[model samples]
Target: MNGRLIAIGDIHGCHQEFADLLQLIKLEPGDQLILLGDLVNRGPDSHRVVELARQHGAIALLGNHERRLLAARRNPDKVKVRDSEKATYSQLDDADWAYLNAMPLTHEVPELNMVFVHGGFLPDRSWREQGADIVTEVQVIDRDGRPCKRREAPEALPWADHWTGPPFVVYGHTPRDDVYKLKWSLCLDTACAMGGQLTAFILPERRLVQVKARRRYYP
Candidate 1:
């Protein structure tokens, strides 16, 4: 409570960039580092990324990437793993699997009226009742008033644009070149695995800290 409540964007296995961003932030004692999931896959070292999060005592959320991987692990015959995620799937050890299993869908800061999640939520529904299928993957809201990925509803507005909140949301998962700031939410995924910057949002001060990726790790 005394230190900053920090939420970082999707890491996507860009371990070096993640490390650099952490150094840049000068993470202090008592700071709560909430990782908005996707801590693995699509970058250089998923294992190292997980290690760093554990070392820093970060609270990791469950992103779609993590959710998919977990599903595959639970019932591989029923789920298809993406080619891009194959390396990370194989790289994760038992501890990493345990870590992923323990991740929460969201973390809340009641006093600040804030909820840190891996992805945006359905604005029209109870945020608390929504499942990972919606919260970990939604980017836009379709004309039918459903949560959808942007490509699924190209002309629709982002869920954040419609969110009216008592609980301001901070989330990741939808990668962009910059942070998407709205009155009720903030999207911090800056596409770090795709030659973009890794972003961190610090509460109380409402400051942003970023570190440019060393290079594009994925196309």
Candidate 2:
């Protein structure tokens, strides 16, 4: 509370980049870290990312990818595995699986005027009013139940464009070429899961930090 507050982007199991970003950040005493989620999967080291994030006392959010992993874990036969995520899923232990299942979908510090979520927040609703569908798979949704390009889409008024905020929402889920610093929020998912840079935003200082991926981990 007395130190800098940092929000990290989607990791997608790029543990080395995650570690490098942490080293680059050089965590100071009292500084707090908020992992914007999707901390696992798609890359090679979901195990280590979760370990490091927890070891450093970072606050992790539940991401869409994590949501999928949780559902699969709960009822293993009810899911199909994708190549990019199979290795990550195979490596996670019971505790790791539970961690993903138990993570909160969103986090906010109103006093800091900040919110942390895995996906986009609906502009028309309050954080508490939002459901997983809105927070886990949002982009350019015309209605609460409407669909967006869950992977990538250029249409539908990007979520940040509609963000009206006091507690500025900081989120991941969409992998972008760059971060979105809108009038009301920040989109920090600089495509870390897709072989892009792993990014983080330092609060109060309002500084952005990143580390390039060691290699492309997924398609």
Candidate 3:
């Protein structure tokens, strides 16, 4: 039998909750753990979160947080930094940096017709053709038919709302009170850093597994 494809939502440095979720999952050797991204920042122990991911050989996608950190590291003078981001920056060592640096923008499972991404894709264009800015930060589609963050265009519809897919997108970035499960896409960033669940989507089965957050780690 083929191995299972398991995708987890944004972790955001909630190490204890992530660790607990892992224990609950009981990952087998054949199972592929695809971390949907935001593996660092906004919570305690970003280093340990990366350590666990590396130890488990998880395929971590590049979320906006990771992208921001990389940009800041590459151009410290150009990119503005937040205190939370600075904390995560200080926590990560060379290996962690390497891991973040090596993260891909997307992962595809052709057999399942699934595409795993950190954020989501614009429905109007080819998902494969989209750049990092769209796939790592977009949450909504503005009236002008452009990808944007929700805060940038409050009245805009979610990008997933417009998506019609064969390669169904599974992503994390826009944290919500619950998993946003649409017909074509699924949003799994269940606000773990803000006292929600750490969700996991098990593929081939399309099953959901989640663990409650220990507490609100960020404001």
Against the reference, the lDDT scores of all candidates come to 0.91, 0.82, 0.92
* Alpha carbon lDDT at 161, candidate 3: 91
Q: If both were scored by lDDT, which would come out higher, candidate 1 or candidate 2?
A: 1
* Top candidate (lDDT): 3
- In angstroms, the error of model 3 at 26 is 1.0
lDDT of 2 by residue, 1-219 (tens): 799998999998888898888889998879898998888877878999998877778889988888887777667787866676788888988767767777898897878777888887766767788888778888766544354864444446777777788778888887888898888888898887677898989988889998988887777
Point out the worst 10-residue segment of candidate 1 by lDDT: 117-126
Q: Mind sharing the TM-score for model 3?
A: 0.97
Candidate 2 global lDDT: 0.82
Give the per-residue lDDT of model 3 (tens digit) for 1-219: 267888999999999998999889888888889999999998898899999999989999999999999999999999977776888999999999999999999999888888999999988878999999989989999999888889999999999999999789999999998899988899999999999999999988999999999999998
Which regions of candidate 1 fall more than 4 Å away from where they truly are?
A: none
- Model 3 gets an lDDT of 0.92
TM-score preference between candidates 2 and 3, better one: 3
Cα TM-score of candidate 2: 0.92
Q: Give each model a TM-score.
A: 0.97, 0.92, 0.97
* Candidate 1 TM-score over all chains jointly: 0.97
